[model samples]
Target chain A: MGYISLDQARTIIAAALAHGGQLGLKPLSVAVLDSGSHLIAFERQDGSSTLRAQIATGKAAGALALGLSSRRIGEMAAERPSFVASLGTIAPAGLIPAAGGVIVVDEAGRAIGAVGVTGDTSDNDELCALAGIAAAKLKAQNA
Target chain B: MGYISLDQARTIIAAALAHGGQLGLKPLSVAVLDSGSHLIAFERQDGSSTLRAQIATGKAAGALALGLSSRRIGEMAAERPSFVASLGTIAPAGLIPAAGGVIVVDEAGRAIGAVGVTGDTSDNDELCALAGIAAAKLKAQNA
Candidate 1:
């Protein structure tokens, strides 16, 4: 299975944090996970809340667990709250049905990893996550 | 980051139990955790509930996870029940929004550890936690 390297994970976190900074967003937290949903790297800005670590990890790991971006998971949640809530109970990392979690894919469109970001509006968080993936020259699953 | 030592953890647990005894409170449980929310030491007095161990750890670990005392979390839960409930799903050690959880801080105001107490009322549980921290000559967060 395709996997994310530690170096790539670090690069994603750095770029994500930088993007959030340039946008004047709140202190952010980022987490990167390999295809198997194991954390490769994580960082939370100094002023970020304590739960940022788990939230970030949940976003990315949740995306991978369901084979969809968290944005889509969020939509699914809106349509089927009970189903989604049940999934959260079974998902080891817990599923966060929100935006800002994006799967990274290789040239062949095979998922390699995921990145999750939090600290601002969900839209802004997703923007930073995408920026990080782009800066690393990685392809987002559907982009 | 500052962390709690085994000796200090033991001290905190012992003192908390003693305080509970002196106050004529019900059989109590105490837990001490390092900065990373890892358990350092734990104890349960005779006749304590079967779930006292998990409850004690949940209080302390939840405080560390949210960067706030469990009392504050309880307040937040009152105001934002759904938000706090979602967090509990993602939190690894579980988040219990009740009293008896206190974060230990260093002179610089950095979190070093946490103490949790449980048995009688939440108020009484918190009192013993404070007493334990005092006995250990450690500072409680915001104190």
Candidate 2:
């Protein structure tokens, strides 16, 4: 299986932070995960909420576990709240089925992982994640 | 620097699980940790008893914290039971000195992460952990 290097993970996070700043979004925490949904790197801008890390990781994990963007996951969860709730139990750490998680694809067109951003509006977070993936020269599953 | 991605962690766990099955060991719970001892991935096979997750995590934590295999920790504890008992109090969640935890090393022999397995004899668990690490082409610290 493919993996995301630490350098690449850092680059993606830096771009995400820069994008969020450029857009004047709130202080944010960004997390990048390998294709298996494990965290490769994470950072929380000063003044961001402590919960931002958990939220960001959850979003990335959800995206990778489902092979879909968190936005799509949110849509499905909205239609089936009980099922989504069950999923959270299955993944004790939690899985946020919302916007802000985007799968990162390698040049070979294979998803290598995901990036999740939190502390801003879901749309803004999603935007920043997409921006980061693009800045890193990786593809975003949805963006 | 090298790091263990979520994909690699999952692959390691899958291999460990398969090895356990081949040996007819009891249901198991496995955990993977980054170099910092942060969780990367985890799984608890169906039928594994409760607390297996915590046990697995503790084992991994102990290995990462001391740079020694859980088996070695157990051996040291055998000689100084009180010190090991004190360690448990310090950890709160309890850090078992038993086997089943191994550090994952990069090609350069730098430890990149750790894996912990629980649910069978400590020796058997260690065997599975070693198998998993080998399958991933990563070195196990105390196979």
Candidate 3:
């Protein structure tokens, strides 16, 4: 029963976009996914490429599925490209082992959801998502 | 600027499951897709088969891509099996020419989104989807 609310999702998205703008990043697409890796809400800022949404969703799905930040997934993929490629076959939406996917944890340290961003460099996208979660007074567990 | 909200998608899924329960149908999986055929929300009820989600998504994707109910697509598939089969190659998520997909139209007669249900017979699936859309006070444009 503990899940991200629509208002919370909206706040995360708005703050993510605002943070991206503050960093002078390109237009971003953000996706909020519940613990089940189901999309709760998504938004694409004006000027963002249409493919951004899919990238954002894939990042979030990969993070949630593995309970790790996509940045970490990227590192793992680097160590074993073939294995990571195989993971894509089983993962829905195809896992993107890239930065920008961060888990949204509740006060109890439970991962309630995740926020993924696409636009700028992977590090910058992760920065924006973390800033958004912090702005909402929530915990971002993808260190 | 109008689009299907997460709240509306949630309401539709809840009502769809409730309708299925009332009708004593089998376990169901429902998928809601935005007008662009992107997944907005999804739920697979307990006891539903693992394939239900994919089937539901394919059905909704087929309906949205064609701007018609999946039943109509099924009819077309029946008449021109080869052509319809070829369509699956290009269709995103692979089209399922079944009877359970229904488009959700707005008051302005624009297709806002779609709901697809799978579990019982395709007829029962379509019935549950339509009931859910009706409960949301939305239009189901499936003749």
Candidate 4:
């Protein structure tokens, strides 16, 4: 049951903030989803717009449900708009197929969970996620 | 605003659970909707039925739109079935004119939002919502 825990969730969020601030990024919203694609914990930085929280959640859920980062899904979604549209209705809340999610992997390269970060550029979002994964002392494979 | 935060949302949910459990009630779903009828947060207990969350949200939205307690609306719905039936469709997204919603007020006696609970009798649902309101230090008035 060590897939993830509250402590790890907090550490990851802290890293997101520390790294994001170091880069002078805007306030961000971050979410951690359990293997079941349900929200474990989420934080919307003070003064961040309301939509950031919802978008972050969607990106994280997208990663877990598709078993891949939303960045890759974004390309596929663009090529197959119909598929993405239908899936939006069928998907869990906050499952946006975009470039904001990164797979949180374990030692065996198994995808254990995922993180979604928002409040900056798409590249910055991915970078913040990498920092969070590193701070958690777990492996992350960019997708 | 300072009237509510995620911490307040979590605390209100805890109050609802404490009240729901004491009555030996079925697992319940509780929702808090902000003044604009946007979902602030929601929770369904582990054993709650799947549709409970939708029911709870609908109830909260109904209260906010009508500016009244759902319990009072339930009474009117019983006598004026036609009005509620028409209302059910007039507003988008299932709005059940039932007694699971109660207004959440700020210290200034203004309705800032509502809390709704479902998965038990109407009385039980109202009980949990009231408990949440009281615990959150918000006014539960005119419902």
The DockQ figures for the candidates are 0.27, 0.12, 0.10, 0.13
Location of the lowest summed lDDT over 10 successive residues in candidate 2 chain A: A85-94
Q: Is candidate 1 or candidate 3 better by DockQ?
A: 1
TM-scores for candidates 1 onward, in order: 0.74, 0.63, 0.64, 0.69
Per-model interface RMSD values are: 3.0, 6.1, 6.4, 4.6
Better of 1 and 3 by lDDT: 1
**Residue B131 lDDT in candidate 4:** 92
lDDT of 2 by residue, A1-143 (tens): 34678998899999999998899999999999876566789999999877988899999888777778889989999999999878877653358988999888766656778899999999999999988888887788753
DockQ ranking, high to low: 1, 4, 2, 3
Consecutive 10-residue window with the lowest summed lDDT within model 1 chain B: B78-87
- Highest DockQ: which candidate? 1
List pairs with backbone clashes in candidate 3: none
Per-residue CA lDDT of model 1 for A69-118, tens digit only, reads: 88888778767767877888898987877789999998888889899998
The ten-residue window of minimal lDDT in model 1 chain A covers A46-55
* Per-residue alpha-carbon lDDT of candidate 4 for residues A1-143, written as tens digits (9 for 90 to 100): 34766568767877987899899998877776656665545566645665675688788878877787888778889899888768778886656777778878777777777888888887798789889888999777556
Q: Give the local distance difference test score of model 1.
A: 0.85
Tell me, per candidate, how large a share of the native contacts it keeps: 0.40, 0.00, 0.00, 0.00
What would the DockQ be for model 1? 0.27
